[model samples]
Target: MTQTDRTDTAERPDPPESSESVATGGAAQAQSQFRRAWTRFRRNKLALASFVVLVALIILAVIAPLIAPYGFEEPDYEHTLAGPGTAGHLLGTDLLGRDLLSRLIYSLRTSFLVGFGAELAALIVAVVIGLIAGYRGGRAEQFLMAITDVMFAFPTYLFAVLMVAVLGRSVGAVILAIAIASWVNMARLTRAQTMTLMQRDFVEAARAMGAPGVTIAVRYVLPNAVGPLLVAVSFGIPAAITAEAGLALLGLGVQPPTPSLGGMIQDGISYVTSYPNMLVWPAVMLAVVLLAFTWLGDGIRDAFDTTGTRR
Candidate 1:
């Protein structure tokens, strides 16, 4: 206990924090980030309302069979062309004597399937191509980007129409056609995000540690890029829905016996001067779906933007 010894002991730094504490701190930080994003999203009143409506619409589509008053194609000979609030036919019957409400409900299901299915297919293609192009760069990047550029050169909707025509009109074909047309945007986005993230300190450290490229891309790069990716997906869903509807309108969508919003609109157009409800209901639903996704996408983009603040 000499004076020099006492001074040396007092000047020594505290021990490094435990691994458990570091893990806890990381978890806390992630939670805080999520909370902040959610708070920002909630501040957007229109977006919040749209999200609720979107969720309700999804639920309705899921349970359409249970809630719809009658089979989508069931003909009510006695109630042909019945108007709204007609006996047993809530929204009335179509030209074929089928219930409008049931067809609309089933049509919703078809639209959602196309939207989510197409987007998911596009996402898979985009992430794989984008990640490889960005992470590997050099010749790989050049080859992949060239293809993406070619896709970008085409008008997306027209390209989709051509693909649908070639592939024939079916739900699966429509989804594939839309995916082929739509994936270029997301691929470019993912590539940019991956390249930017690859330059980050953590990613560089992982590279220095001799981690495999796939491991680094999946473990570090992908997670960091998820926010922007989610925003992109939110926007893409509506685009997919719109494409499906347009195809259906043009008679190149899912074939007969499978109802779709666009098909309903097409059917209603001939009867527009007669029973307008046939045209109005499906059009209104389509408009609502488009608006809801657009608002939600904007909200998500704003929320994830660290530089922006929503008042």
Candidate 2:
């Protein structure tokens, strides 16, 4: 009952309540969390409305080329600044006589394009640098954090404008500018979350179990950190959009006759007193985008809170 009994016990498989079970149970718990969150989210009237509005805007942007009645570039001077419900143009024309509705559709697409592209670029850089900064610590952390500090010190709008100016006022430029400007925030967030998550017992357990550093960070630390990261991304999209618009407003974004929202506002501002509608529509659209994103972000934040159901 000594050596032989010890050997047999050691050879026995892990118990049913071991790590594998924990994984399975954790997955189920995650699913349950998602269901609960969704149930709560759906009950939020403002959030639901905002979600619907965002979906509709996305759909419109996607189908713009096919459904736009008139080419955004095509202009009818006779209809310039015409009030809504004109002969042919529903929303009227801009200073260049371009179709307002069509231009707006394109602008929405461009805004979303820049937002998503910038976030993607930032995400790539942030994930790598952030994980390294958090996991490696010491000099690596110091260097990376120092760089982030420098980025933070620079004015966000000015930095974006300068980058876009260097790159030129195109869609790619806008995306590149915002990405470069915005990545610091994401990197900081990632580093903080990673540092926190890396200290968890599960992460230590993974390390004890001989999991590689990258594996532990990617598989365990990152997944848990993704919730807040996702919230950051949700918030980041609107910020990017606003940045793009601001750049365009300064005549530093998409070239004229292209129907960018910022450009439209710029044009409409001159005639705001005479043609309030010109500024009105674009302003409303921008407001809607801002509000929708805010609500969605709030809803997501509430869902992921884990503290309570109220948002």
Candidate 3:
């Protein structure tokens, strides 16, 4: 066939009578990529373990209320400060006689909520900004990168603290603050990936096929460029969780009558001299959860590296 025929073929919409071969091939490619990625990820036993633990943590957080022996706010004055296993309060009680286990579970839920919610917001903003900046290059790219640079210059936690403090320390506010603070990394990641992918022959082919700018960016460039952003998302979650925990620890997060891992830890610190378990469990959980997120992110990065270095 002639070049014109090939270009027409590339740009032509499939007729209603067309077979499913094209769709099937695309599905097969996607499935193959996923299968390969999963294989690479599984080869890193620690990352696989981390992913499993992370899922378990999310499940545990979801079921916390149903499984807890008592309400998070229910006071057991008689059993106040009770050590582990007292009256089936497995993790013990805090100074207020609240079951530590119940509070811990609920607090965990809050932390994870902040993590996932904030990361989602950040990713949305990042993807949009990155797509515009990278695909549109020249003046648009320069302007967008300038803004991203300004955002990066500010300390992320400090920005979050300022935002949450101004907006009041609610869950939504915290998520918003973290999003504003953390989207820079994702934006930069996506932009770099887009720039790299835009130079490839497939992108040039799409451009030469009379594709509109937005269509090419969205359908061809964005999807292909998301690999780096996927890794960024994995890392961003932990950053968000830590940011929320820090705010809570400093007494700027979820107020009293509400349980959050950081707030609970702050409360536990007062009694840490006498009751170490109060401070220990949440701290351990935070560490383990963050470690899991980091491991999983690393695994995903390696899996999608495209360098064929993954074993």
Candidate number of the best lDDT: 1
Q: Model 1, 206-253: lDDT tens per residue?
A: 665677888878877777777888899999999999888888878898
Indicate whether candidate 1 or candidate 3 has the larger TM-score: 1
Which residue runs does candidate 2 get wrong by more than 4 Å? 1-33, 309-311
Q: What ranking emerges by lDDT with the best candidate at the front?
A: 1, 3, 2
TM-score of 2: 0.88
Residue by residue across 1-311, what tens digits does model 2's lDDT show?
79999999999998644454444443455457667778877888888888899999999998999999888788787776677778688887767677788888988988888888999899989999999999999999999999989999999889998988789887888899999999998899999998987766666666666778888777777777777888899899998888878887788977766766777788789999988878888888998998999999898787778876554
Looking at model 3, residue 10 earns an lDDT score of 100
Residue 260 Cα positional deviation in candidate 2, in Å, after optimal superposition: 1.9
Off by over 4 Å in 3: 1-32, 308-311
| Tens digit per residue, CA lDDT, model 3, 94-148 | 9889999899888889999999999999999998999899888899999999999
lDDT of 2 at 35: 77
Is 1 or 2 the stronger prediction by lDDT? Answer: 1
Question: Would you estimate the TM-scores of all the predictions?
Answer: 0.90, 0.88, 0.87
In model 2, how large is the Cα lDDT of residue 135? 94
- Order of all candidates by TM-score, from best down to worst? 1, 2, 3
| RMSD of every prediction | 2.9, 4.2, 6.1
Q: Report the error of model 2 at residue 225, Å.
A: 0.8
